[model samples]
Target: MKIIDQNYINGEFKTIDSSKRLTLKNPTTEEDIAQIYLSTPAEMDEAIHCAATTFESFSQTSIDTRMDILQRIHDELHKYEEELIDLAVLEFGATITTTRRRTKNAINLFLAIKEELKSYDFIKKDDYSITIKEGVGVIGVIIPWNANLAHLCSNIAPAIALGCTLVIKPSEFNALETQAFLECLHRANIPKGVVNVVHGTGEVVGEILTKHPLVNAISFIGSTKTGKRIFENCSKTIKRMTLELGGKSPTVLLEDANLAEVIPHVLSSAYSNSGQACHAGSRLLVPKAKVNEVKRLLLETIQKLKIGDPKNEETKIGPMINQTQFNTVQDYIKSGIEEGAQLLCGGLGRVQEFEKGYFVKPTVFICQDQTLKIVQEEIFGPVLCVLPYESEQEALNMANDTLFGLSAYVFSSDETKAYEFAKQIRSGRVLINTAASKAKNPPFGGMKQSGLGRMGGRYSMDAFCEIKSILF
Candidate 1:
């Protein structure tokens, strides 16, 4: 077993007191894969100071230099693709196929950043004034456990490409992947202290990063409740914040939509990542005339999903992250049953075949009451709530009723009508007759309580930059 028991600070791996350590478990086997010492307050302070001090010079580095560094990092990521995928399968309980796709996405983001930097204008000239875009300085990135590798790259790609120094706090659940990523940065020979990694619970490292005086901005990806707390903490110093929070996304199926084509998309949206993803289309709104048929189709398809060892290339649904998440999802399943929602397919308990690991059956509930708890809250599991709608206007209203505005979907034979309807939904991005995975760029984030800012493609540049106007 490979053990990573140190934090990366000042361009070097430094050891922490082993007495205070966090053990990371393989969700598939419920066994310890790696253990990392939690960074002390003093260690976090050292990282912040290193980043702040380094930014003065690192932020001024030439764009070509930054692009070269990004290219090196991208190449290193590809070189270690198989190893990273193996770690993800062991730590993520992720299927090999899913892990490969995620690794590809991570690599592609860096490549995209490099390509975009070629045309990005750091200094724009006008008649009398010159507009300048510079690094925001000392970024604090908080990554959630789900899709840790992909989200880690999503933030770091733009931060580094735009010449910002970073202090990253990846969730303790998957610190092994963080260690591997930091190794890539080290091998790529990035400037000393330009990037740092700290491992600990969010309360310890996360709070310090948000409240640290030297930190200029905070970029977070997690729950709305936690995002709000980070916002409140960063507001004290008037620091910039880009939060990508929770989502209870909805998918609206039009009356004329073909059931065969739409069911697959809907299933992929709702059950992707075993329904743990924030943007998972947890709510499926179909015309009342077709609710029964939709439920039957869902049942047939869901039952056919291979729910077992994530190592299998064929497995689509893996175990939940840990016992706590497993219990949370189970509670939500129980809540649906108790609240009078009809259980269409799966309900309660583990996948009988597995004795260990946190696995919940892919659950589907046909809900008549939109006001029910199951329909309103984010279960963050492979649970789908099927809601019936009588009219197009009603479906639109139902979809927009949630507190989250992260993502929405519309499927229709009429392309123009679907486009117009997408405009009405309050979401950061909308997918029409397609899976969210088909997105080309990273212009993805949340609106309302879903999130505060956008991060993807050229837009991510906006997150880690400070704009200034200079008179000629």
Candidate 2:
């Protein structure tokens, strides 16, 4: 019973006008674990007001001073990392290892962003005039549930470092974790009103945050359909938005690839978080001649990934977040079956070892058509569709055929061939062997529907900054 009913506003914990409150639930055991204050439009306005007021001073602060505060935030983050991980494990159904690793990565991202900002030339000076990189005011951040804490810090650390104040609307599914993270922020001594967290459904908190007058910019990570709606909403204010949307990314296995070694990459790409990630390598494409061999390897590799309790240290695959997600994943599994895809491995239902959690089995389907719903859509589940292609050109074509272009992977020992194939696939990020070794300094973002703008390093700062031209 960790109750996070206080919304951070103006350097204090205050309750909103709404009498209605909600308890954040842990889906694994169907337990109500924490309570949050459900918010209103007026509460959103108050947050925007505070953030806007704080930005004037925060934005003009020296880079060195800002870096010092960021360092403090990072250190404090590391101190509470375990408790944060515990909350993540309980709320999001992430395994203990995943929760701990994700927390470290998030804290690392904060450190990396701080270091990146230290040497960043955010302003230019002239004899008669000065060019400034001023803060974008009253930012609105919408974090996805899959990797809520890390994703929040990943995009937000840089923004705050660049002197931007923001209102964050973390996914309703992960509100309890967010409340705890905000509590840590307060403990870390981040100035209130500099960052505010509001809890509610998308229609209430999300829509209000997007449409707020003082909110000059927005950053959202979710599906393309939702991203499109958010983009449209912000268009009314002509707000600058960073949209990290959907992905039906492909893993291309060249004819020369080693099936045994490459199989691990395929499993990690497609089945991590039960394949709920935006960049999960869901659509795995194998060469026509090697299709059967790769399929067998993929099935074996995926089967080896431990699935069950989120609290288990050995578990690699955890339960789906909630009943809605479980049903959606099951529907996708059913979609593959009904669409005439050959069921090569897992089909549906719970793992034999776990009966209580909202779990989905690791499912694989071999489909001839690359354009089917299961193939083309963002299933966001453990289900993977393996498609065969006649030639390299066809593989690249099919990989780039989706409306979502978040990430793409190519596995080949031939460097020249890998780079050539990477160029043809239209994605924001491309993984030749692995996904950039999960680095923090690498610029993280997607191209096209994957979203606009970039994050990580100086890119994170850029999202929060605006340029001013100097004329002498």
Candidate 3:
């Protein structure tokens, strides 16, 4: 088995001294793949101190210099594309298609940020005074495992663009993938102490990053529960924070929407990343009259999805991250059955063909009750809950009833009507008749308990910056 015994700190790989180690397994085969030496609390402290010290010089870097670094990093990422894709599939159980798309998107983020930096104005002047936006100093970055490299690159690009130093703590689950990414950062020739990584559990490494006084801001993408704890911890120091939390996003099909055209889009959102995405449209809101038609289309589409080893190019669905996640998805499916929701397609247990691995049946449920656990909670699996609404007003109400407002989808033949309806939803991003947004560098975050601040484009830059007014 491969062994990962180093943490990237001060632009160098330092051997981890802690005895605590996490063994990683291939989600598809349930076989041990690698063992990672976890970073200790003292190591986390060293990373933080390195980042804090680096911020003094890094934060003063010129925009052109920072842009060059981003470009170099982007180029370096391209060299590791194949390795990154392979590791994502082997470790995270992501299908090849999903891994390719995620890896591509992650690499492109650096170029996108570089473009944004080209014209970005760090200082604005009026007749009376000049307003300055400076890097927020040492930043603490914590990311989840669902899209390890994507989250890592996403968090890193913005902070780098703003000339902010980072002390990042990625999930221990994707330690191997994280190691590959760290190599990319190292080869990019990033300045010493500009980017530091600590590999350990959240209770250890994460706690230090969250509570450290030297860390000026935090950029985290994880569950709502962990985000809450981080928020509370940051409150003690009153640090700037940008949190991208959980979502139980809704896919609304208006009465006028064409079932043939829209059902494909709906299923894409529902099952993207094998339904492990935080913004997966797990809730499907349909007009009461169209429920039957939607159900038929959903089953027809789901059957065509190839579920098996992630290594297969044709495999669309892969196994869960591990036994814990598999059990969690199973529990949610069981709750749906016990709560009286009709299981239209798929049910409890693995696919008949697969005897091993954490593969869950891609399930769908027809439910009227919005209070059901399957309807209300973030299942983070290939499970979709179809909720029928009698009226458009009711549809809007049902879509916005959840505690999450990260993302929502609206499908209608009438573009104007769909746009109008999308505006009323409380989600941070409302896509009309599309699973993905085409807009460049649009703000991404959520309303209500979903998140506190935004990321992407200038919004991300703002998150890592401190604004000041210099009066003439």
lDDT of 2 by residue, 1-472 (tens): 7665667788777876777776767868767887766788788778888888888887777777777777877887888888888888888888888678778988877778777876778677878877778778878998889999888888668877888888888877776677767767888787667888777767887898888878999988888888889999999999998888888889999989888988887888887776789989999899889888987787777767888778888788888888889899888888888989999988877767765878788888998997788998888888888999999889888888888888889999897989998998889888898843655466667877788888767877877778888888
lDDT winner among the candidates? 3
- Which runs in model 1 stand beyond 4 Å of their true positions? none
Candidate 3 lDDT tens digits, 308-351: 99999999899999999999999999999999999998899988
lDDT of each: 0.89, 0.82, 0.92
- Please report the TM-score between candidate 2 and the true structure: 0.96
- For residue 275, model 2's alpha carbon misses the true position, in angstroms, by 1.1
Candidate 2 off by > 4 Å: 125-130, 435-438
Q: Between which residue pairs do clashes occur in model 3?
A: none
Better of 1 and 2 by TM-score: 1
Pick by lDDT: 1 or 2, better one: 1
Per-residue lDDT tens digits for candidate 1, residues 284-321, read 99999998789878878887789989989889899998
Range of the 10 consecutive residues with the lowest summed lDDT in candidate 2: 435-444
